[model samples]
Target: MEIYVTIKGKVEPDKMAEFNGLFDLMVAGKTGAALETYGEDTFPAAESTLEKVLDKFEAAYDSINLESYTLEQGKLTLNFMGSYALEQILPDLQVWLLACGVKDVELEGNWV
Candidate 1:
């Protein structure tokens, strides 16, 4: 089974830059670039915030893989794919995103 999950939200204004760097790290194959781009001082905290959400998925739902993402104008949309049922993952993901300072979190899932 192929399940697709789309998450939409806004990163708080002050957090957008670091979030963008994180997005680049995740989606653009730019590992460790966020640390350089965001500076060592700011990047660790920013990376930790992103890590909390990823660690949840990794620890509890290892099947899902974040396939892509876009962060622009304070809005973020993350696309994920996996074999797991969407309902099993969405609620915790929504909460994790909220905890990471993403506002107005919304999610949708479909199977293909």
Candidate 2:
């Protein structure tokens, strides 16, 4: 099934640079300094966003394919092909968003 994941969040003015840096690096196929190499407590300070979340899923879950995404007005919509329950991943995604300096984040998933 195809899943349409809508992620709504705001990057504070202070965090916009960090978020943009991470997104740009990920989009450029540059996973700087092996992010996965960092321990739980040693994770880099780069803020997460749509790209980071999708990149994590792509690296960890071969079953999930992120086909497209759009970000506008603090809202991000991700279209992916996967067969997993959103409930299983929502919690972690929420935490990532919070750590990424995103305020009042909201997430929704629909099957179509």
Best candidate, TM-score: 1
Error of 2 at 71 (Å): 6.0
Residue 40's lDDT within candidate 2 is 24
lDDT for each residue of candidate 1 in 24-101, tens digit (9 for 90 to 100)? 655654434343444345544344544544455556555336689888788899997766544466776676567657
Per-residue alpha-carbon lDDT of model 2 for 1-112, expressed as tens digits?
Answer: 5456666677656545555554444444454443333212233442344345546566666323445554555554444345554445556666765765567777666666
Which stretch of 10 consecutive residues in model 1 shows the poorest summed lDDT?
31-40
Candidate 1 local Cα displacement, residue 32, angstroms:
12
Model 2: lDDT of residue 72: 54
CA deviation > 4 Å runs, candidate 1: 28-64, 85-87
Q: Mark the regions of model 2 whose C-alpha exceeds 4 Å error after superposition.
A: 26-60, 63-81, 85-87
